[model samples]
Target: MKKAAMTIALLIAVVATAGIVTGGFSYDPAAAQAAARIKVYSAEMRNYFMSDEIVKSKEEWRKILTQEQYHVLREKGTERAFTGKYATTHDHGIYRCAGCGLDLFRSEDKFESGTGWPSFTQPIAKENVKTEVDRSFFST
Candidate 1:
């Protein structure tokens, strides 16, 4: 992560330097051509991922969700016990991912586990759920 940040900073610095090409490096037409080729490649990559079930950049997600929503969905966060609006909610609709709006648990499957957070018997479908190792400290 640190390396990625550093690389981004370096690229920014290079771009700033490019504005004053005579300062150190000479302007090269080949570099511009190479950049155009990269743009084409990026367009192709975007087209490939366009059909994904959920495809959005981190910034795009942040724009889609409010700060609190992003923290829970993108950051794999858990709401405080007895604090979530849905914790005590009893609606007749399906529970969906706040991030991508994917149908997760149906209202009929909801049950009270006395665990504060909403609990469901099983996902609406196996493909809609992913059970990763919850590395949060709360996952004792």
Candidate 2:
């Protein structure tokens, strides 16, 4: 478990640096109050997962999530562009994971990427998210 956590932490750090490029947009790190918000959300996110890690069976997830969510999250399916609820939202708040309710990104980190999906500059904290290399369709 420790090793896994360390590996995830390292991956998260790498993802943080890659966040802007991955989304094809950038946010101003010098934006007013950005640092304070980051600190607040980072603590909130850390506290959120202070308890046991979440582990749910597919059957359980199906019961908890909508069919669409199950398709996108569990089956690794994609939603049609611009169809997500937060895709065009301009509200200010932290964005939580649909599957586990983990606080993942802040509204401040989000930018207008025109990709029809909500794009964030970074997670609230590197530790709050996980990353993996996608080696699909002849790309890494």
lDDT of 2 by residue, 18-66 (tens): 8756763566666534433422234453453333356689899999999
- Report residue 94 deviation for candidate 1 (angstroms): 0.9
**Model 1 / residue 82 / CA error / Å:** 0.6
Model 2, residue pairs in steric clash: none
As a whole number from 0 to 100, the lDDT of residue 52 in candidate 2 is 39
lDDT of each: 0.73, 0.76
The segments of candidate 2 whose C-alpha lies over 4 angstroms from its true place after superposition are 1-49, 138-140
